[model samples]
Target: MEYSKDDLIEAKRQIDSTLHKLKETVKTLESKENVSRLKSQITLAKRRIKAFEIANYFLENEIKKDK
Candidate 1:
């Protein structure tokens, strides 16, 4: 699907926001007394954060090219 420049920008903004929250979650999870209990959730969040980061990078490049 072809996304308009504005749509891409909006997606990038949302991804950035989610990335921030995911990082905070990872930090909080790691600081918990029972880190092992939340290992899977932490790992999942980290993976999702990585995926979003890649998407954000692509969106940024697309936006730059659209300029």
Candidate 2:
């Protein structure tokens, strides 16, 4: 359950990237039919990144508790 500081940093970066992609996807959604699949992909990426962030938080807490 323990993660290094680097792991936490990476997780945060990934979450940020996913959020950015989601924003771009939303902007595209209003403009193009061809982008629906890309939008769906970004939506799933957002969900996954969210889950990763939540899990990373809990795991980090657990690591701190163990210390």
Candidate 3:
């Protein structure tokens, strides 16, 4: 499906917001004294952040093309 520039822009904004939150979560999780149990959570968050980063990169390229 084709999305308008505005829609793509909004989606990019949401992704950026999510990316920020995920990074913060990883930071918070890593700072814990005992992170044995949180290891999985931190790993999952890191993976998610990576995925979102890829999405953000595509969105940025698309936005630039839309210009």
In terms of lDDT, the best-performing candidate is 1
Query: Model 2, range 1-67, lDDT digits (tens) per residue?
Result: 5667667667666766765675666566646777756776757756765776677576566556646
Cα TM-score of candidate 2: 0.49
* Error of model 2, residue 23, in angstroms: 12
Error of 2 at 42 (Å): 0.3
- Total backbone collisions for each predicted model: 0, 0, 0
Per-residue lDDT tens digits for candidate 1, residues 1-67, read: 8889999999999999999999999999999998999999999999999999999999999999999
Candidate 2, residue 60: Cα displacement in angstroms equals 0.3
Q: Relative to the true structure, how large is the alpha-carbon lDDT of every model?
A: 0.96, 0.65, 0.94
> What is the full ranking by lDDT, best candidate first?
1, 3, 2
- At residue 52, candidate 1 shows an lDDT of 96
Give the alpha carbon lDDT tens digit for every residue of 1-67 in model 3: 8899999999999999999999999999999989998999999999999999999899899989989
Candidate scoring better on TM-score of 1 and 2: 1
Count clashing pairs, candidate 2. 0
Candidate 1 residue-wise lDDT at 56: 91
